[model samples]
Target: MTDYVAKALEVDIDDAVRRVREISEQEAMNQAISVVGAGPAPGGAEWEAEQGTDTPAARQTAWQLVRLRIELATGIDPFGTVLGLRRMGTTWATIAAAAGVSRQAAHDRWGKQVLGVLDAYGTGELGGPVADDEADLRRGMAR
Candidate 1:
């Protein structure tokens, strides 16, 4: 997509991704609880009412689902980090180094999104001021 279009939709994309991740996380937790009753709380919190059939296979399936959810959620932060780094003028090489990938790989993965963020900033379409701490991170990455 053109940088302008990407920029225009950047916020919407972020919001949509976040919403989906949130839903996935909640669904994973719910499925896990359904399988194993929250697996015995440690802080004296009672488990919620059970929902799914409590069989060994069902429990295993729920566990797998929760694991997959965790993996998917974990993968999203790198996308954000890539955008943040690109926003800060960090070179693709540096970002790739941190990610343990070739520069082309990094760009292939996140370059468009990063470009969108840059476009947003240029057009004054970014929704809010970046946090101070994030700026510090940018500085650190610069060096």
Candidate 2:
């Protein structure tokens, strides 16, 4: 992708993450509504019962949604460090140090590949617009 496109993707990802967070917050509000509608309780029992059932499911769903948001925002598949490095730019070196690898090694492994694929896919030079470039890359690499 061009730098502009990459930057745009970053913006889009940020928006998507914000939207997901909003949805999660809404979900929490929905749970609260349910609890409120369920009526007054005698000594925390009803609240505890609701908590036992709703909290776990809500928490799990929220976490999963956040994970998806992270994936979309970063454009990096799980275990692929490229998106993080690209997003960090010069700070990638510091990230590398924290990850216990030399900066160059980290860059070599993760830096250009995602952007290269983005460029290829964005320009329609690699077949066509991909539904998901990361998934396409993974499939292409597997073949």
lDDT per residue (tens digit) for residues 1-143 in model 2: 36997777666477787787667555544553454343436367765676646554444334433443354354434223334333323244543553456655654566456457546455734333322324443454567
Q: Which candidate number would show the highest lDDT if scored against the true structure?
A: 1
Candidate 1 Cα errors over 4 Å, as ranges: 1-73, 120-143
TM-scores, one per candidate: 0.34, 0.26
So what's the TM-score on candidate 2?
0.26
lDDT score for residue 24 of model 1: 61
Error of 1 at 123 (Å): 7.7
Candidate 2, residue 113: Cα displacement in angstroms equals 1.6
> Candidate 1, clashing residue pairs?
none
lDDT score for candidate 2 against the true structure: 0.47
Q: After best superposition, candidate 2 residue 64: deviation in angstroms?
A: 16
lDDT by residue for model 1 (1-143), tens = 46996687664577787799777656655654665554544344332333333543344434544443343455634454455545444566666665667766766677657657756556744444322233443555468
Give lDDT: candidate 1, residue 94. 61
What is the C-alpha local distance difference test score of candidate 1? 0.53
